[model samples]
Target chain A: MTDAHEIRHEIRIATGDDIVRIRRAVRTVACAARMSLVDRTKLVTAASELARNVIGHGGGGTVRIERLISPSGVSGVRMVFEDAGPGIPDVRLALTDGWSTGQGLGLGLPGARRLVDEFDLQTVVGEGTRVTVTKWTR
Target chain B: MDRVPILKAGDVLLVSIQTDLEDRTVMALREDLAERIVRTGARGVVIDITAVEIVDSFIGQMLAGIAAMSQLLDARTVVVGMRPAVAITLVELGLSLGGVQTALDLETGLRLLGAGPLDGGPSEAQDRR
Candidate 1:
């Protein structure tokens, strides 16, 4: 396995404009990983959704983009969105399709999960929420 | 404040989203489009998203809202030039774009809008790109 350390690029999600920056940053890393166009689009779209959630629900936070190398030498891109706002009380309910607490289509979380290969969510009602997703290069 | 350009072609209004969209920009687009439809009395609206590489749930909702608004304004809205990846993403997101009409390209969308009577029938144009 490669070293646990990888280069991480951080972006502050303060406003709507920052979401555009997050997408662009994810795209650059995805392209550098040599992911195909379809994969790139998928990753970028997923990142966009997560970033929007950060701004709209999470009240803005930070997004970290990292280059990951698996034990088998497979490379991928990992994005982590962290927000310090009202946390989701029920993670299961939030992940369910068509279940949204905000004025959204309720597709942000589940839809992002479908677009990525690895998905992880951590949240505490009063603390905050963090979502990490990865798309490996095929 | 970068606004998407809205062009008028004969009786149709063409809007091509060529840049990354912000939330506020999208809201402005909705308002601008509604105003243009009223001023031009356009019978058809063609939205070209070929330049856009991604359409998340937010954008998908925006498109659907625009289509519904156009329908209410007595204008047929046809969304064209969706990238293959974007289409796949939208479907995966479980967004059917409900009432929005789709076409493969601008030409087909315009032709479809022109050939049919407003509110007569659905366009026969294939949705592929």
Candidate 2:
């Protein structure tokens, strides 16, 4: 919200195969943004975790990827994952490590948050969930 | 889903993962490995992930699950060649991969399994090729 963003990609998160595709696409954008190897790996890992969530809990969703540019000219990447499935009942519990509403290890939401610089989550109990993560170049 | 090739070298069953794995692919690898272990009666399993770019919780669980399965089949498992960033992220994610051994690379993984003090019976994880 500080400066500007360029939309890069929109992907469907409906199958296991899409997990790989989502990671690859996020990786492409991250690399193009000149992120460090560690940064790229972190962002991609986070993307994969979220995509799996969309497939597992959300029952399918959409991922929107964008490139961020600050007023000072620094660059970054942002990924928004929106799911129309059952929204979380407790955001705090969902963020807790080792907790899960599904078969996963309960790391997806919390783990993804740590991998990026900015983390935002919005959800309505019956409506859906939207998770946006951003990683800015230092 | 692309299947990771499994090769046999002496008493060790080697698996070099070189692709972005989906959940189904990991499940397939697990089944394939379990069957291979029983079929060959291998003494050790070495999984090289040096080329792998990341290890989210799901993939981390797959690695642990494989090691556990191999242990049950009387084969020691060693995961090798993890990138530094992957290591950092896995730790941050709270997955220690409990009960699975790790090494710097293929040779070290093989050696660890060969001399591994874990449950698998003693044998040379020899490279016959």
Candidate 3:
């Protein structure tokens, strides 16, 4: 029931150094949301993975982080990563553990999903991909 | 390029990663650690990650690679001081770190490496001081 005037942070993810910045930004917003340390770590880790994917697979993108207030007055942190690189042809396979297109461990997507309470993925073949995740504070 | 310091402690090398690691920096660490092992003839390495708040798949893979490389050079690698949250995220991410050994703290990690079968005889860890 809170207002939509929550603070939003936008970060450009183009290089490996940006990954660190993404994690730090997520940590700051998570802290502002009054999340526990453990929750904050989870969110930041997820953010790191998503940001890396944007750079490695999506050829670079932007990450948007914001403080969210649910209708029940519950507060949380949300992050959205968007990229215009070659989109995923099969999100299901991409999410499967141990399935990687790159030289990664293939845990990025699913692992990020497990760390957050809300997960949504949008992709268009030959266009781009967008991943959104949210972690609610208990 | 920012480099992580590697300290020599007798038969062991202690590497504490305190900064937010860049990919190139990690790549540099791999090469530097390998050269250091060859130069020092150290039998064990303890990597302290207590100050690191988040570990992505890339960093996780780097740790695993370092352990494997050290083993090839006849050195045992032990990772220690993983925060509880990092541990949880690593598991959820499906990375067990496979071959690398882990301990709760640097002290325990040194002891584990010293007592390892490859180490042989009593620990010379205190001799470095």
Supply fnat for every model shown.
Answer: 0.87, 0.76, 0.83
Order of the predicted models by DockQ, top scorer first? 1, 3, 2
Q: lDDT values of the candidates?
A: 0.89, 0.88, 0.89
Worst 10 residues of 3 chain A by lDDT: A1-10
Candidate 2 lDDT for residue A128: 94
The residue-by-residue lDDT of candidate 2 on B31-124, one tens digit each, is: 9999999999999989999989999999999899998889889999999999998998888777888778999877668667664423455434
lDDT of 3 by residue, A1-138 (tens): 446446789999999889888888888899889999888988998998899889989999999999998888889998999999999999999989878899888888988888899999999988999999989999
Prediction RMSDs, each to the true structure: 4.2, 4.8, 4.1
* i-RMSD of all predictions: 0.8, 0.9, 1.0
lDDT tens digits by residue: candidate 3, B13-99? 889999988888888988999999999999999999999888888899999999999999999999999999898878876777878
**lDDT of model 2 at position B117:** 28
| Model 1 misplacement above 4 A | A1-7, B115-129
Look at candidate 2 and give me any clashing residue pairs.
none
TM-score for all models, in order of appearance: 0.92, 0.92, 0.92
What's model 1's overall lDDT?
A: 0.89
Give lDDT tens digits, candidate 1, residues B1-129: 899999988899999999988878888998999999999999989999999988899988999999999999999999999999888888887888978999998877888898433444654543232
Query: Which candidate has the top score in lDDT?
Result: 1
